[model samples]
Target: MVLLIGSSMFAQSVSAADPSLAELKKVLQSQIELMKPELKGKVKDLSMDTKMSLMAILAMHSRYSERATLRQVMTEVLSDYQSVLAGIMTDNPEHTADSARRLANHRIPVGGLLPYLGMENISDERLAVLDSFNSSVEGNALKLADAAEAGDMVKAASLIGDISSGCVGCHGVFRSQPGVSDLLSLK
Candidate 1:
């Protein structure tokens, strides 16, 4: 009887400690969702140049060689991106501002594409476009972030719409890449 009781207790503890895959996915999805309002607004109003720059950054970050699988690349990218965003949201104003500026520059390297695609090069045209987009949108995104941080959800919502429009404009101009499409597809 004691053995059975101990086994049951062990099973309960294990179950509590190990979240199900669905639960894990939901947590991740929620985190992504939390940033959506800001992202959508900024994307909508982003200049073509800024959009192109962001696309290039994402492309560069998503690149992978034979060593890493697509899933691995995506996981790492998302994790890193989330960390960056969290830092922006929680850090001191000066640090957040500096980090925001750095991201705005789009100079940070995020390694290669997904492993399945092997080694691939980023196109000059794409990079140029992204540079333009980043320059145009970064300021607005920062502004929205500031408002959101201040608890002004109304301003944040308006800005989020603007961002979404910028994104739509870019998608209209350029063929939507699979990754871009998937990112935007989130409700």
Candidate 2:
């Protein structure tokens, strides 16, 4: 809410002057950077009791409800990746590189969550798994981008599979509908 209010104020200031898109983006990025430290402080070094409290608060976040957009972006990037592979197989580096660049440049808001640390350096194990998953995804995405930029279709082809594995693995763990309650399943 604060951020939105701040952004609106910033926008109002610029709207009268008709700032360019690039200028608005720069202002937005600067505002976000200014907020980062304060934002990070809120969630950092939480106690166990705080974690429990946060669980209640977070229950209202609609995170699962938000996954559809993430999935759609992933599908688009994956589709571009498929064309990249086809281009590689057909010995068309230009097509392969073009598609790969398209995949690399895809952007969206709210990619996903990262792991959190608590007061004693403890973390939520589930979020830890997601952090690992995100790392794998990021590394593979970078490699895929680099390979494509260098017109190394063979490398890009291999990376697409690796990146797909990261996505599949994360979805399997977090997105699956379980047959039993975790407590009952554990027993």
Candidate 3:
């Protein structure tokens, strides 16, 4: 009876370790799918906005890697970002102002990744990047979230690039962390 009780407790403990990775992946994928058309429509420059979005998504991917099962899903999501950015960059350089307006609607989700990453306890260097980004001209432009809502893709894309640069700078630091090199390389 003692051994059985011990085994049962151990099983429960193991089961409670983390949420199902598959479920997490599914949720993330669904979110992306739902956001895509909206994303394509609202941004003037897909190249810049896509890169910014990928950086944000990668931040989430970093968190998902904490679990083994979710690692595969994380990889898939990262690949999607890469592919989308590549396609956008390679395709057209010009878009209708109306399309840009539509894409701007996704600003909330696009920008929301910053706080999510912060919740993961961003490094000091990363925090600095975020600060710099917030104070930048482009960042200031985004403060005109109202302008973006009014279909100002020009202002929105500019701000989005600044945000993307911040993410890249931080990720550069994140990847260089002593033990994370191997993990980052998977992307």
C-alpha displacement of 166 in model 1, angstroms? 2.4
lDDT of 1 by residue, 1-187 (tens): 0000111222333443455523323332332343334333433443444433443344322122323333443444344334445554564444433443333333221121211111121233433443444433444556655765675545644554454455455445442233322222223
Reference-based lDDT, residue 28, model 1: 26
Extract clashing residue pairs from model 2: none
> Model 2 off-target regions past 4 Å?
1-68, 109-123, 176-187
Worst 10 residues of 2 by lDDT: 178-187
Superposed by TM-score, candidate 3 places the C-alpha of residue 114 at a distance from the truth, in angstroms, of 14
Residue 116, candidate 1: how far off, in angstroms?
A: 12
lDDT of 3 at 25: 37
Clashes of 3: 7
For model 2 the TM-score comes to 0.46
Return the candidate ranking by lDDT, descending.
Answer: 2, 1, 3
Which candidate model has the greater TM-score, 1 or 2?
2
TM-scores for every candidate against the unseen true structure? 0.31, 0.46, 0.27
Ranking by TM-score: 2, 1, 3
Clashes of each: 28, 0, 7
Question: Distance from true position, residue 40, model 1, in Å?
Answer: 32
lDDT of 2 by residue, 1-187 (tens): 0011123333444543554533433433432333334333443443444344333222222222112234455566678778877876886767776776666455431311211122222244544454455445555666766776687767877876676777688676665332221211111
lDDT of 3 by residue, 7-101 (tens): 22223443334565334334344333333332323322223333344334332332332222222332443443343334234432233222322
lDDT winner among the candidates?
Answer: 2
